[model samples]
Target: MNFEVVLTCAVTGAGDTTGRSKHVPVTPEEIARDAVEAARAGASVVHLHVRDPQTGKGSRDPALFRETVDRVRQSGVDVVINLTAGMGGDWTPAKDDWAMPGPGTDMIGPDERLAHVRDCLPEICSLDCGTLNFGNDDTIYISTPPILRRMAALVREWGVKPELEVFDLGHIRFAKAMLAEGLLADPPMFQLCLGIPWGADQTVETMAAMKAQLPPGASWAGFGISRMQMPMAAAAVALGGNVRVGLEDNLFLGRGVLATNAQLVEQAREIIERMGARVLSPQEARNRLHLRGADA
Candidate 1:
C-alpha cells in the first residue's frame, strides 16, 4: 500500500454538471477560485477544463484557458496545474447520415485540440489513451492511435507530462506500445479512469487489474465516478497507487448533498489519512511523478 498519495482535484469537468449543482464553476474566475480552494484544502494537483461562460458548455477556447490558469497562478497557490487535453474529440454522427457529423460533434485535428494546452502550458495534461463510446449515446470519443501518437509527441516537445488516461485494458496495451515506440517520456504517469460508462467498471478488482499492467517506473492514480468515488480512492491507495477526487467525477458529498471542489478534496484527504497514508503536497507530488517541477 502507498504510504504517500498524490491527490488531484478535478475542479470542473466539461460535463453537464453545472445544471445539477451550482457549485460547478463555469466562468474563469469561479474556476480559478475553486481550484485554489481545493489546493488549500489539500489537493496536490488541480485538473481543469474550460467552459463557455455564456452557455455553460465545454469549450476549446484558448483565451478562457489562459485567463483561468493566470488567475490560479496569481493566487500564490502552490499546486500542479493539469489541463484536460481530452476535449475537441467528440463525434456524434447524424441520425440520418452515418457519414455526417451530428449536433454534438466537435471533432478537430490534434493541433486544434492542443491549442489551449499550448497556450496555458500546464505542467501536465491528460491524454486519453483510446477511443470510447463515452456514454450510452451515439457519441464516440475519437482518439485513434495516430492521433494519440501526435498528441504524445506534441506534449513531449513542450516538456509537459501527459497523464496517460487508460480507460480499459486495450487502452493500456496501446499506451504500452507508445512507450515502446519512444513516444512517451520516461517514468510515465497514468490515471486509471474507472466507472465511466462503457469503459472500465468501478471495482477493486478492475483497478487492481489495471494497476498491475502499468509499466515499470510509472506513477499512477485511480478514480471512480458518482457514488463510487471515495471507495475507489481508498482502493487506489491500498493498491499502492495515488488518488483523485473532485466534482469532475462526482457531484455529491453524500446522498442528496451537492459538493464543492474543496469538500471533495477534504473528504479524499481524510480517507487517505484515516488509512494511515498522507497526501503529498504540490512539490512532493511533482518530484514523485518526475514532473518539470512547480516552476515549469
Candidate 2:
C-alpha cells in the first residue's frame, strides 16, 4: 500500500458530459474557478480540458485554453497543472464515404494537438499511448506509434512531463517501448485510465494487472469512471498507486447527487486518510513526479 499518494482532480474533460450536468464547467472562467477550488480542497494536481463556452462541447481552441490556464496561474493556487494533449485524435469515418472523415471526426496533426502545451507550458501533459475503438461505435481514437513518437519528442523538448495514458495491455506495451526508446523524461509518470467503454474495465483486477506492468520506479495513478470512481481510488491506494477524481470522470457524489470538483477532491482525500495513507501536497507530488512547476 502507498502511504504517500498524489490526488489529481480532472476538473473538466473533453467528453459529451456537459449536457448531462450543469455542474460541468463550460466557460473559461468556470473552468478556472473549479480548478482552483479543487486545488484548495486538497488536490495535488488538476487535469484540464477546455470547452466551447457557447455550445458546451469539447474544444481545442488555444485561445480558450490560454484564458483558462492563465486564470488558474494568476489565482495563486498551488497545484500542478496538467493539460490534455489527448484532443484532436478522434476519427469517425463517414457512413457512406469511409474514405473521408465524418461529422464527429476531429483529427489534426501532432504539432497542432500540442499547441496548448507549447503555449501554456504546464507542469504535465497527457499522451494517450495508443489508438483504440472509443465508445461502442465505429469511431476510433487515432494515435499511431509514429505520431506518438513525434509528439513525445516535441513534449520533451518543451520540458513538460508527459503523463502517459494507458487504456489497455497493448497500450502499456507501447509505453514501455517508448521508455526504452528514451523519449520520455526520467522517472516517467503514468495514468491508468480505466472503465471507459470498450477500454479496460473498471475493476480492481485490471488496475492491479496494469499497475504490475508499469516500469520500475515509475509514478502512476489510476481512475475509474462514473459509479466506480471512489471505489477505484481506494483500490489504487491499496495497490501502491495514486488516485484521481473529479467531474471529468464522474459527476455524482452519490446515487443522485451532482458533484462539484472540490467535493470530489474532498471525498478522495477522506478515502486516502481513512486507508492510513496521506494525500501528497502539490510540492510533494512534483518531487515524486520530477516536475518543475511555474513557480520553480
Candidate 3:
C-alpha cells in the first residue's frame, strides 16, 4: 500500500441535504468556518460549494464564492481550496412536455457554469467529465462532451488545475480522451465519485475498475457517499489513490450519529494512519495536485 495519502474535505455540496440535517453549512460564513475547522482537523484540501442563504439550496453565485474563499484565506489556515464548477447543470424535464426543461431546472452554458471559477480563481476547480442521470425522477445532470472540452480548455487557460470528476466508466473514458487531446495539464488530477443513485455504485470492484481506467501518471482520489465514505478512503489508498470525506457526502460518523466536517476529517486521518500511511499536508498536497499557491 502507498504510504502517502491526501485527504480532502468536501465542506458543503450543492445537494438538498441541508434540510435533512441541520449540521450542513448554509451561509458563506458558515461554510468558510466549517472549512477552517476541517483544515484544523487534518484535511489538506477543502472542496467548496456555496448555497443560497435563504433556501439552503445550491447556487453558482460568484459573490458567495468570493466571500467564502476570502474568509478561508484570511483564517491563516493552509488548506488548498477546491471550488466546484458543477452547479448550473441540473435539468428537470417539464411534465407537460418531456423534451422541455421544467421548473427547478438550473441549466446554463459551460462558460456560465465556470464563471465563478474564473472570478474566484481558486487553486482547483472541478470539471465534471460527463453527463449522467442525476437524482430521482426526471432530473438529468447535463454535461455534454463539447461542454466538457470547452470547460477543460478554459480551466487550463486560467492556470487552475481541473479536478476531473468521474461518476461512471464512460466519464473515465471521456476524461482519458480529454487528456489525450491535451486538454488537461501534466499529472492529470481526478476525483472518482461513487454511490450516488444512477451513477457508479459503491463497491471495491467498481472503485478498482475506475482507478484502472485513469490515464498514465495520474493523481487521483475517490469518494463514496454516506456509510461508504471511510471505507472508500481506505480502498482508495489501498489502490494507490487519495481519499475524500465530509458532511457533503455523509452526515453520520456511525449508526445514529451526526458528524461534522471536522469529525469526518479526523476519522479519515485516523484511518490513513492505521493503514500505515501518512496523510499529506496542505503544501504537499498542493504540489502533488499541481495547485497554485496563494501567491500564484
Question: How far in Å is the alpha carbon of 146 misplaced in model 1?
Answer: 0.7
Give the residue spans of candidate 1 off by over 4 A: 294-296
Off by over 4 Å in 2: 294-296
**What TM-score, computed on C-alpha atoms, does each candidate reach?**
0.98, 0.98, 0.98
lDDT string for model 3 (119-189, tens) is 98988999988888887788889999999999999999999999999999999899889888999898899
Ten-residue segment with the worst summed lDDT in candidate 3? 287-296
Candidate 1 lDDT tens digits, 1-296: 99999999998999898999999999999999999999999999999998999999988899999999999999999999999999989999999999999899999989888999998899999999999998998999999999999999999999999999999999999999999999999889999999998999999999999988999888999999999999999999999999999999999999999999999999999999999999999999988888886435
Q: Which stretches of candidate 3 lie over 4 Å from their true place?
A: 294-296
List the lowest-lDDT window of 10 residues for candidate 2.
287-296
The positional error of residue 259 in candidate 3, measured at the CA in angstroms, is: 0.5
lDDT computed for candidate 1: 0.94
Please, what are the lDDT tens digits per residue for candidate 2 over residues 2-32? 9999999999898889888889999999999
What lDDT does model 2 reach? 0.93
The alpha-carbon lDDT assigned to residue 147 of candidate 1 equals 94
Which is the winner by lDDT between candidate 1 and candidate 2? 1
Report the poorest 10 consecutive residues by lDDT, candidate 1: 287-296
